[model samples]
Target: MEKKADQVSVWCIVSMASIPLVMTLGNSMLIPVLPILEDKVGISSFQSSMIITSYSVAAIFLIPVAGYLSDRFGRKKVILPSLILALIGGLIAGFASWKMDDPFTMIIIGRVIQGIGAAGAMPIVLPLVGDLYQDDEEKASSCLGIIETSNTFGKVLSPILGSIFAAFLWFLPFFSISALSLISIVLIFFFVKVPKEKDEPVKFKEFFNNTKKVFKAEGKWLYTVFLNGVLVMLILFSMLFFLSENLEKVHDIKGIKKGFVLAIPLLLLCTASFISGRKIKGDIKTIRLVMLSCLAVMSIAVAFVGFTNKKIILLLAVTSIVGIAIGALLPALDAIITENIEKELRGTVTSFYSSARFIGVAAGPPIMSIVMKNFLNGSYIVAGVLGVILLFIVFKFIKENEIGNQTEKA
Candidate 1:
């Protein structure tokens, strides 16, 4: 039974990891091709950004509902259907791009469907991971790191892959996402083994009561995590939007060249997330120290992007450094939330966290576009300032608490 559980745990981790990877690829992959999409669809820059934001906006609103459902039902039950919705969305978007006279509207609609699916899928993984290793904090922490690494890996691949698909045809990326989502669905259905729950499903009234109780007790620290989540994602997507736009508009770099160039910072981000996920484990001290240091590093690096010139090498170096900071921040935040929350409450809490993150994603590109249009350096300055604000919140709220209780697992 022990060996079997270990094997199931490993497979579950792999399957859960794929959830974020596919989600990132579905969204981030389109960043490099937004210019092409703008031209092909005859949309304004802001409208093109809406392509990305629409998906996140939908996810932002629906994520908490999905989280609640997953807690009430089961992870796989919620996840499998969500992937199906994403697959349907991908196919709809791809078909519209290939055959329709006006594909933009259809594509946005598809993205909304994809967002609904995303709301249910990735957010459920954190709590499911907690359930898998109920007693072992170290293993759970390492597993969560692997999950974060996969998410970053998708970001690393998105630009390169999206650009490659766009080179052949602008719609190919949508088809690619459909294919990826299909694969994820199969992997999850066949191999991922969720541990059986012994407790009866909580009634809606009790669920709400538990949720209220949790916030009353842990609201300060949890709110800090939520804010940090939004800030990091905002900084990340904003910088990516800036880099993708600048590379094509200013340097005339496009196609695979642009993709590879855009990927440099994300590669660094993936590396940072992988390392941080493992090192932070379940230690609250580790989470605090890592987040504080990384937030400082990110703020300084983004400030440089705003303050400096359009020198290509300098921008890449600074963005790459910022990527490292974000990478560390993500898993640290994930560990803090997942390790501390009770299993029944984990999905709901982390879903709220994920929703906060989607809000950042939804806002990043459009806001950055407006800022960059007005003043090139202003975007980076704005990101840096936000980072500093988040750092202070973390410093003030995230403190040493007694561990060992299920709700306060340190």
Candidate 2:
């Protein structure tokens, strides 16, 4: 009944972890290689940005649908097909990049397809993780933390992997998506054994009504979590984008050097997530404190960044602090959302949360590109203010409850 690491094969956790990592690498691994695409395809920079945006945009709209379907049919049912679809999209993009004279359009098309598949992939994994250790909050929180870490780790690895893959052939990163997805698909299929649901799938009308009731009961806390998810992701990606640009433009750092420099904050984030996940362990009080503290720290660090000049070392130092805060916040937020929600509702709610995250990803670069370029230090100031706003929301709205004692029904 208690699906601890020993009871549930560590391989199962690894399989689940692969979903987020591959999902991340699938999209992000293209960032550093975008310039190469621009050179090879003769596309403008804005057009190049669209290549990345298309995938996220596609995922954003479909994620809730995917979540609902997963809840109805099963997570594995949704995830396997989605992984296959994502792999297909990667191959399409890879082939077009390899063989086409004018590959930009096809590449975009492929990315959109991949995005559609992604809507069902990583988003679904959250609920599945929740399902795994349903009777064991400590393990569940730890597993969710691992999932979040894998996702952040992918962000840290993306630029480096993109550059390395591009060194062999510009199209290799596109193909890499397929390779990564295939790995996830195989691992998931063989190792991730989801527990069977005893209840018959609810009809759509009943399902919709139950979802509404859930919001009615938990809307305040849930909304705050969703907002925080969006805000943190938006700020994180925006900061990374800003850093990547300045690393090359201002510091004259480029290529692998730029990737390593860009990775510092992300590595901080990844480490923070792992440690926070271990510490929280489904303690409701600890979760709330972690959220509040992380948000407070993030706000202060970002405000400091706003005041500081664009000196590379100072910027990295402040941003790395922000990264750690964000990294810590993620697991706390995730554990709360996952542990408190009813099992039947977990898939859909987490889907919405994942969609909020994708919204941030979709908007971050373009938003930061405009804000940082024109508004100067205004970007950090805005983010700092938003972080403060989240701090207030979390403190005011997140009620103290014994999450481990939550009643489970499916």
Q: What is the lDDT of residue 122 in candidate 2?
A: 94
lDDT of each: 0.89, 0.86
Q: CA shift at 100, candidate 1, in angstroms? A: 1.6
**For candidate 1, what is the total of clashing residue pairs?**
0
Task: Return the TM-score for candidate 2, rounded to 2 decimals.
Answer: 0.94
CA RMSD per model (angstroms): 1.9, 2.5
The Cα error of candidate 1 at residue 123, in Å, is 0.7
Model 2 spans with C-alpha error above 4 angstroms: 2-7, 304-309, 402-410
Off by over 4 Å in 1: 1-9, 402-410
Error of 2 at 125 (Å): 1.2
Task: Give the per-residue lDDT of model 2 (tens digit) for 1-410.
Answer: 45445536889999999999999999888877776787899986567777878899999999999999999999999999999989999999999999999999999999999999899999998889888788888989989999999998998898888878888898999999999999999999999888877889999999999898787767788888999999888888777766766777677877777777778888899999999988899888899999999999998898776455368889899999999999999999889989888788899999999999889888887776666666857778878898888889888887686233323221
